[model samples]
Target chain A: MTKKIPVLFSVGWNACINCGACVAICPQEAGFISPFDTIAVDRPCDIACMLCEAICPVTTITHELAPLKTN
Target chain B: MARYRPYFTLYLGSMDKQYDLVIVGSGPAGATVGRFAAQAGLKVLIIDKRQELGAPIQCSGAVSRHALEEVGITPNAEFIQEPIYGFGIYNQIGDCTTIDYRQLKGDEYGPEKGKKPLGYVVDRRRFDRYLMTMAERAGAIVWLKTEGLGYAATGNGHCDVQMRRFNEFLTIRTRILVGADGLQSQVGKWAGLRTHIKITELASCLQYVVDQVETEGLLEIITGHEWAPGGYAWVFPKGHGYAEIGLGVIPTMTQQNAQWHLKKFMEQSFFQKRFKNARILEIQGGGVPLASPLRVQFADNLILVGDAARHVNPITGGGIHTALSGGYIAASFLIDFLQEDRDASAKNMEGYQEQWLAALGNKMWKLHGIKTKIFHNQNIVERDQQLYATMSDYFSPHSEYKKI
Candidate 1:
């Protein structure tokens, strides 16, 4: 059986202001944002929880379900 | 996503922990309430999602001396960057106006006649940690890097709060909950409180901390449509050749965002030369709600304070003082409700709203009106100049502007 993962929606990077609110609020530490850059500090983990999306002040982060491929 | 379900279930096993009050966010408001409640002997727990107590700084960190006094905080030398005595307002057309603290009247939160400093620019990161230390000393349990995910009001008036600490899930049972989670509070949403602020009522802001910059003690405020269409730009000195340069804009009024305006302001002839050799230390940005307080801030087993309650000053976008006051006020009411009445029902918490209104509601409403008038006019620079020039006469010393 293939597993599933969470991915950043298309609008995530463009809409993100790099406020780090998403990074702070993410329960699984899925988001990696930095004040020095406009992009994510690290690739977000595939945590299914949408806390980052729910807590984004600008509604910048969103997520979608993706299949996890077996090696 | 499905791969994480089993991990979630593994962490869901409840660890028995309970408190009389649980406050979220760990900012000034949460720390203040936690300190007061713990000092009064209540079992209090305060949590913040941030790894550091105050990181990814969101504020310009200006607060009046009286605001500090009202919350029982003495001006600590370590965190105070500079003492401000007045403001220097400049227009795009090169008009200037200055308002001195001495010209202002005394209000409930104003300094005494002989007081030399009207306000101080602070290091917010240090200041917030200092407040958390106070709460810790007073016996409040603080959990850094803990995010409050959601909560459910148990039928008996207690709330079961679900939280995530890094990868671990935990549950906390509390008699009362306070949401100090700021402008986009998840706590407010989970509590079913009406916490929405219209887009027109929000100010999007961005700032840069520059070192080796030339600055005087007085704060410099620049205004004009060309500078910041719906708001203003400020250069607040942090002493020893450091300053915070920032601007705010109402998104609805301008085609450009705050960052665009800030860049434009920096390139202008007046500031370009000064910033040429200055070192950019850090960048900060966030949104602030510029509106009246939420009509309903209390629900069954819950209360909202600070920016979560939209307690920011509508005109100045200042919230630190109000957050402190609101936290202290909420703590008082919670003490009365929990200790005196031995109840934490929504009904018992109504006093929090009532008392807060008596303290700040009327003033905030009036400022909202003034802010509306100021922002709607065509000549914001001229109107702002006139307003500041006559502020000593038009507003009492107790005005929100004085404290903000």
Candidate 2:
């Protein structure tokens, strides 16, 4: 059974300058900034990596640990 | 809303027509190219991802007068905030080595042709708007709120570009696709070019535009691991008591984010004394690619310019001059490439890369090497005195880093 899992979320505390830093650095292509420059850097981010959190220039992204459910 | 109505449908209509040139991103680089190409009679279309061009202020707005003049813009009060005469380099403990530009000697990054003042801090929004305006006035159609999805070679000396505005999608068939989008260039990536900077090669920066902080009219550059590891902070005077206090840190080297480091840096007694009663105006964050310039900046009628091509100086994180120059080179080449009936193969586009290398790419590579040796040198990551000595030696226009 899976145990600890990392969940990603936008801290939402920082303003999205729409700089596209996170989108450029996401090796997994888990994030993107649209033409409208929306705050969907991680609209539905799946955490294979937390590079977005580490490299967000404004510190607007981070991760949390969650216990995995098993049968 | 200025951004609504979907430009994909409004401008191109339902017809599938091919433009001579299509540029993504309306920043200095994109607009410069658009202006030149359109003025030369190329059917040009420039698209921007934002509703209002130059909104959200993603840059520091500092550029040499030569940068503006090179792009054919005259320096005036409309955008010039203040002119800097020199720099004051400081270390972690606040040791300062102030140098006046008139008294200094350096190999490059010097005052251009005896131009007074090293550079001017600008209102980036106004400056950016000005460039885009020039592009539109030169007959290039400017479409806001349009995003370039990707592009592909039609395999017939033309390329197809896909873009979206709101919920609508449109395809722009063009002779050449120009990528001027910022550091993270999805278009360049689709063209099979290296578009992403290694996390270690990235400099994450946060800045606060505040009033009542004295900057002594000189750009105050601060260094040291305690404040900014693998990068540095600066205090740029905006005129009269307003200054932008900002710092950049290598994401991979620091355990803390830019905000955390900024907070710690501000909490220092030195900053506390200086920032007392200061009125906070605005806060901004951005990232600068501190890697070597991208070697292959073009592919099969697809070209990358500005930060999209990683043209920024690795040591100083400055891109304005290179962006304007590179945009000009790319546009000039595209004019001849199209008029001379040249094929769209990557080999044919080699002239753009060669011209850019002789003009600026070589300098950028040298800066990248020096940066790796000084700023990101893991061996001296914690050595304060040694770090400041080398950083100041290379960074100052008055001092030569080679002597060190």
Candidate 3:
């Protein structure tokens, strides 16, 4: 059986100011800043563009988007 | 584009079932328009997600006096942080070029003329709350700690809005819907308006309030890719010897994030000398959409204002002026549409877009052109002196103030 790879992403809520930068810049609408001043990035679109990771001001959006990074 | 509502939501109503105008986000744009619509004898409802108004501020707070007057706000001592007399602009090569507004404007702006200032930086928290009060005093019903989820157009220039108040869900209907929400305009998205803050047109920003560093009345602005790639760093005075030191960067232009860029910016000898013994007072970070002005900002029953419409200045990342002006413009058309034939159709709402473009759209496009030609290009990164020469021509004291 082939081993399954998982979609990789994490949010460092401790560093998140809850400014909603990621939410505003995500073209895929994949991210949202929680009401408790925390952030969650769970959805991965067909392209997995990773624009959220790039546009995050604090670099809090970490995602292992494949092919683009899996050299 | 239409969104279908659940059957359960159709029967949910704990408050007033409807309003003439329903506005989301009680920021400058939302509150201003809400005030006008209410003042014009329309039943208006305004809501905000923030428990407190303008908490964790996300602006440099600088606005021209003419801008405030245009919005009918007489500058009061209550929220005015400091009066900026000029700019302490620095080139990438460490050369400083300062212009005193008094000297630039001459007799028209000097003490002999009147108590005029180049601009004033106000406390955003207090200022936004002041607008909320203004909206409420004008007969607009405001609900705090309420968040707008989405809206569904119900034909004939009306919409059914979904929102949450604490644990209780709220669904309110309105003949005219206003999405004055800031940068993350989910209202526009839910209403099916193209309001995305694209990555190419995004500027990731970070700012800090620090004390113990004495700054003058002038706003210190530093330009160079070494500090903030495709963006700039600033020191906006916040009184009590404190200043908001911040920088923005085009994420696509650099591998590093805004935090990394700010860290590197502060570590430089120029900033190091200023913040040697400074204590951090507050830290905030956000994004500014430096995109070209939207050609269309309304659809059917819904109209977008402020950052939701990408109204921020493309080159400076400033929006208070246009944001305030946009509220007035929206209210102008809205008062007629809602009270006249009660028509909030896409055809009628297009009038709002036309008026807004006539006021500030061309100037914003010009700034976008300059932004694209220089900062976004990245080819002119090393030409510090050349950049200053061209910038002075456009931004100098003698330059056109209307475009600024």
Candidate 4:
């Protein structure tokens, strides 16, 4: 039997503007980043609330739509 | 026998005789109320919780010269930092445009004519103390280091205000109270008024005083997420070697700490290359309420003014002038209430609501709509930069000029 892990939507690295809207609106505190040091502050988005997707003005966020299977 | 047994009497305690009117917080609102009421011969007591009158100030200290002129306050050598002949804008793509305030159309927010400039960016401590001094000169009793604890309302009508001064509890009884406290005002809540400001409707702000800027007198304003998202960064020349370098963002888009965001911007590609040797002086942070027309700002015997009433402009986030205007209006309504013999209840305070709405309510509402429309764009960051560059010429002049 395979265990299922929650999959999260991720933003395109090149399109990410570092606006931080995703981090501000996320209820689960999953979206975290360091604005001062870009590229070093990416984190996993465990909560599937999609708050970031709704707030992304340019719609750069991509929904995974499927949970990853865990060993 | 007279049909009445001598009614047993109950004493509600002796009235505290400190002042007829007590104003909490010595910001622009308190100062205006104190100045006007004191000049009207009403005994006014002004109290501030801070050890000093205006230490740890929380404002950019920007104001229009016209606003001070209306209040009969003049800006001389001590207050005026720069005349600011024009405004500057920079886009995400690094395009720069300049706007001359003197050549602009529509109702503007500064002095009309003079070599001295349209607005002043004074030292906040000095400006606040100056206003407090003016109120004192008008016969208002100044009580520094005094903190307003709570409002004590009697079943009859008057209120006993509990204040702590130098570890001693003092009571002041007044027929009227003016709450000039800032955004986090306790008076608004204590008076049963709504203090709800949605996060999306707030501007998260952070500023730093930096020295040794390359730009001489030119104020630089940068837009786009490259610096601040849903907001802008400004480098206002403060004469000598100092400049107010800050950034702001609509609360909805601002995550992480404000200071961290500011530091990140300072280290950005543009700023780092230009401002390398500048020394950091002071760091400050605060929020500006941007909720169009606030739901409520008045209640029984209490009128919220300044940031307390959400008087800040929605688009510009410039509030010093509005706060000054609010102070004056709050004073006017208070004067009327002082002269009237009627009970100073919520019904009577309605006059203030009407007067404020007449003056600044509609402008704030229109600006709110403009802000909502501007923020909803999928590509606002790029669009804003374009808008700023396009309108730079129109924003330059002082008088009404067409946006070309």
Give candidate 2's error at residue B374 in angstroms.
1.8
Please give, for residues A17-57, the per-residue lDDT of candidate 1 as tens digits: 55644433443421143423222423444655554444343
RMSD of each: 7.8, 5.0, 5.7, 11.5
For model 2 chain B, the run of ten residues with the poorest summed lDDT: B395-404
Runs in model 3 deviating more than 4 A are A1-8, A29-33, A36-39, A42-47, A64-71, B1-14, B106-114, B376-378, B381-387, B401-404
User: Between the candidate structures 2 and 4, which one is better when assessed by lDDT?
Assistant: 2
Query: What is the C-alpha interface RMSD of model 1?
Result: 7.2
Interface RMSD of each: 7.2, 2.4, 2.1, 10.3
Candidate 4 residue-wise lDDT, B1-404, digit = tens:
64542233113222236566788889877888799889989888888877665455456666666778787787766656655545677776567776645454314533454244556677777778888989999988877767777786664557788888756687888877777766666677677676655567655667778787655445677777656777777788765668888877664575554555677777874777667777888765455555675567777656788877778777667767777887888788878777876677888878887898778776677667766676777686556754464335334553222210
Candidate 3 structure quality by residue, lDDT tens digits, B1-404: 65676655445422576999999989889999998888999899998988888877878898888888877888888889887777777777567788777777766654354658777888989888899889999999888878888777877567898888765697899998898888888777776777766687888999988887777777777887788777788888887667888998888779998988888887774778878777888988788877787767898788899888888888778888888888989988899877777567778889888888878777788878877767534466545544465455555667653444
Error of 2 at B31 (Å): 1.0
> What is candidate 4's CAPRI-style docking category based on DockQ?
incorrect
Better of 1 and 2 by DockQ: 2
lDDT of 2 by residue, B187-286 (tens): 7877877665788888888888889888765777888888888788888988656899888888888888888888788778367788776676988877
TM-score of chain A of 3: 0.55
2 or 3, which is superior by TM-score? 3
Which order, best to worst by DockQ? Answer: 3, 2, 1, 4
* Winning candidate number (lDDT): 3
| TM-score, second chain, candidate 2 | 0.88
Best by DockQ: 3
